[model samples]
Target: MINLALLIFLVVLFTQIVSWVGKTVLQEVAFAVYSRVFLSGTASKQRQLRKQVLAEKAELGWTSSQDEFAKWAKLRRKLDKGIADLEKINTTLTSSKTSFSVKFNSLLWILMTGSQLFLVWWYRKQPIFWLPQGWVPKPVAWILSFPSAPLGSVSSGAWGAVCKRVLQSVEEIVKAILEPTVVPNGPFPTAPFPAQSQSQPSAKIEPITLEHEKLD
Candidate 1:
């Protein structure tokens, strides 16, 4: 029997991979990855050629302004060549992109996610961890024990859920650490001149003289 630690590790690792890479991207690349691995002979050669064309096109970057007609003409020719080669390869690989995509993606989901679900179900009745009795309230204990697990024990389903959540949090922290901080735009220049202020009439000040001085 595998130790609880090993089960936790597997669940965490798979969850992190699926969560980080994203399911959509994995599905998109499934057919591309599969053909190279499982096909042979001419199919393998076509895959290799397609890969080479893609790498070369990526290196060429996007088409820019045609400042020099000669250079622009050459670039355009190379771009067209790459596109033609890709189309040829795609046509050779499968009759329909939509049909092939659905087939490979479904296979990937069945193999990856299906296995995870099976593992959790197979171990549903078993407890991953045996906690001390009376440590938690009856309701809390029941939740931890859930399904068929004995009270005061942590069920496989609950523990796997916790482990996956913790791993996802760590993945987020790692991404945040690797992300570069954006420097704010430089200080913008203010108005060239101050605005003119409205002026009000100035009141004349009268100085008061002492009574003795006035009398004198």
Candidate 2:
């Protein structure tokens, strides 16, 4: 009976360790995969669009100015329009990116929770060695059992809850960390910004001309 008790304790301890390891690995892997597949891809697409816009802008130039000031005004308007269009595109991209990240984060927590639950159920039938032996005196057994019962239950539940909550908290933190400091949506809470503002707009715009300008 003493030996049996020791064995059970070891099993319980081992399972706890396994649970911890599983949670850690899952969290890390999930975050990495999400960043790589979804986050990185979104960023890359946005970058490509920006580069294409720049190239288009570079193509538009004034070879011969029939109406220098009027042409300049037209060009300025066109540039502003292009920039506004790019801004809209960027907004859409950013919104989609954020939405994907949030969904991915939520999914990760779900997976972690599911995995932990499965592990718990798998080990449920296995006896914990730390538990007091029934053969022992009532007082001794009760005393020994007290620690494992409460501690074990609390630790298990806490771990599970913490895993879920931590994942959610982490997502919120990431948004706070990555989100733009300046609110583009104005002071009042009207609507959420389309994407995180990574870089501020430049003070001066470099003028360039394109041979054939096309509006999208």
The local distance difference test score of each candidate is 0.72, 0.54
Off by over 4 Å in 1: 23-34, 37-40, 43-92, 95-104, 188-216
Tens-place lDDT per residue, model 2, 87-141, is 8767876676567667765765555445455544544433343433345566654
Maximum-lDDT candidate: 1
Model 1, span 1-216: residue lDDT tens: 879657666856875787678877876677567656664554866777677777766645654445566765676677788678767767766764567777766766665677567766777788878888789889999988777788888887778777778887887899899999997799987867643443555667999887654564
Residue 117 error, candidate 2, Å: 4.6
**What lDDT score is found at residue 66 in candidate 2?**
56
CA lDDT, candidate 2, residue 211: 84
The TM-score values for the models, in the order shown, are: 0.56, 0.36
- Tell me the alpha-carbon RMSD of every candidate: 10.7, 31.0
